[model samples]
Target: MFRGLSAFPLTPVDEDGVDLTAYAALVARLAGAGVDSIGALGSTGGYAYLTREQRARVAEAAVDAASGTPVMVGIGALRTRDVLALAEDAQNAGAAAVLLAPLTYQPLGDDEVFGLYEDVTHHLSVPLCVYDNPATTHVRFSDELHARIAALPHIGSVKIPGVPTGAEDRVAALRALLPASVALGVSGDWTAVRGLNSGCDVWYSVLGGTFPRTALALTRAAQSGHADHANDLSDALEPLWALFRRHGSLRVMAAAASHLGLTGEVNLPRPLRGLDAEQRREVVAVLDALGLDE
Candidate 1:
């Protein structure tokens, strides 16, 4: 379940909270497209912003809409107790696994972060994926810290941040530290090809959530050892990647999903607005140019 394309869909929302119909459509689309797993409440899904009741509803909705595709729900929260509660909610909703980032307001030491995982993992019934997204979570996981966490029971995967050019050695070193049972997954939509070609086991993707076939093509190409094809596919999406770099992926993807009519115009949570009209026009132009508007 952890190995292949794990598509993280947006949790479409408005003033009414989660638009379960649209959210379910997104999950069902990815499932029909044959993604390896559906990641329901990752960063892309705006898990941090949703209430526990809302998150529980989202988890249940995702599993139900998955059509038997493995579903992994994000269970991150500020406190360890809340995290445990979220984990239970995910398990009760029938999640195959749970993704956890060290969501924090105060800066945390390595020991504190390690303790967080240790406490959560001790009571988790489902497998856990250690989400190492320092860019958002602000708590970076050193190789040693990762090794410690990966040793804990139920640590099925580690979703490492982007792999830069020529990062094979870095990936290899981390791989050597982890147990063979722990899959090394990659995040960062733009760097996924490089990560996969460098022997990462999975791509926990934002792109795949909305553009499953396109992302799947790239994923399959890399997994099949077709480096040239994978590189070409990634290169073709340079314009989209540029947009992602300019505006954060959450905003860009929200724009894409909105423009495509997959979700409502006011999809994002308050204070986090979607792209302005001008930027959205640019997104549309890029989509048309890339022949992705279809």
Candidate 2:
């Protein structure tokens, strides 16, 4: 049961490979910050960009550094076999749960998506978090499909991405549709307060990994019904969120981490470049304005 906030830590990479030292330190920071769980190899972690071996090493490092905090490893892949292989690897590495997104080259239909999760859930003892991220996967789960997945054995939670307009109604509808056992989490830090206050059980946050103290404070405020405080905190982080929207969180986060001296210059896998100097300067200004220049 990964309730509250689950921080999705970045997998710092260099010319050599995944930087285990930086990766572990990030995980330790999140665990010590008192987040409910750590999500390794997530979109923030660049799971789709890593080789199988690299992903395994990333999972192992995350679990080891978690220090009793639950670690949920992303096990999404283009193929069913690859997804299962990563899920098995996560289990062997002591991951608490596996998150699955319906990733495919061709557009996937409802039955195909259902079948993919069905096959994976059968082989696992640990719980699965149904990841409905249409932005990346391009496959959205309808309410009916979500209910079908939730009814499957060994499924624990559902992670819904984005906090679209009328999010309260969306949250209320999903809360009514999903089983009480399946907790819904809201991604996209901008929507976290609205989603959490709307009955989502957790915030699957990217900011939480890089700046856990502030993220945790916001979550606590939202959870305790401090709408004004939560709104103030969300407003404070709006500048960084604006950059996240413009340049994408992956690039902005890598730049943010390096700016904070938490990692070396992160070279994401090929075809992805970090922020240009101009964008980096904007990030620096945002970080400094928010007192995150450390």
Candidate 3:
């Protein structure tokens, strides 16, 4: 069920609160675009910045807006208890699944990470996807830990961040260890095509959420064995991906959405600024080049 393009949309917000209207529009746009799944509150959604109440609202809006598309909510918290409560919220809000990251203030060993998933699995009625994003969580999952987590009851899939080096070999190694039933998804926009070719079953995509048509086209080309077409599409998206690498994707994406008038002025949480004038100009150039500014 968690295959193909799983669009991870940003939570459009202003000082007032989460912009459910814009948020719902974004979700509806993705669903109408034939995206395979919807993942609200993944890294791009700025899940970490919101309060529990805010997160609950976002999940509810996402599920309702998705209109029967499978909506997955990112349920990451520093505390396991908090994770459980968030998972319960996702369930109540009618999310299809919950994505759990081993978010920790201190480094967590494999045992601690495994215990976290084990506890969450017990509480959740829906399937869980293990989100292995070390960049935000500060905890990396080893192959052993991935296998152990996949073996747990109700555990469904794994969302892997891009493998910076030796992606094919590493993905192949993980695929070998994981059960055939377990789905493997790749995030990290730049490496998505490579990961899909390497054997990832799905993509947890940021770009796809904002611009579903482009991302879905690339995924379709790659999955259908059109390597040249897929590579060319990835190459075309490199400029936007470059901004994502330099300025951080969430900030840049919000700015892009606002520029396109897809969503009005996206207000991130305090202390984190959006793009500057120069960066905004660059985003405009990329969007125009991609014909996305219309």
Cα RMSD (Å) per model? 0.7, 1.0, 1.2
By TM-score: ranked, best first:
1, 2, 3
Instruction: Compute the lDDT of residue 101 as modeled in candidate 1.
Output: 96
How many angstroms is residue 205 displaced in model 1 relative to the true structure, after the best TM-score fit? 0.5
lDDT of 3 by residue, 1-294 (tens): 678899998887766778888889999989999899999998888888889999999999999989999999999999999999999999999999999888888888889999999999999899899999888888878899999999998888999988667879988898899888889999899988888877788989989878999899999887888878888999888888898999888888888888877787755765667888888898898888878753
- Candidate 2 overall Cα lDDT vs. reference? 0.89
Per-residue lDDT of candidate 1, residues 50-137 (tens digit): 9999999999999999989999999999999999999999999999999999999999999999999999999988899999999998
On the 0 to 100 scale, the lDDT of residue 215 in model 1 is 94
Output the number of the TM-score-best candidate: 1
Greater-lDDT candidate between 1 and 3: 1
lDDT of each: 0.94, 0.89, 0.88
Scored by lDDT, the top model is: 1
List the lowest-lDDT window of 10 residues for candidate 3: 264-273
Clashes of each: 0, 0, 0
RMSD value for candidate 1 = 0.7
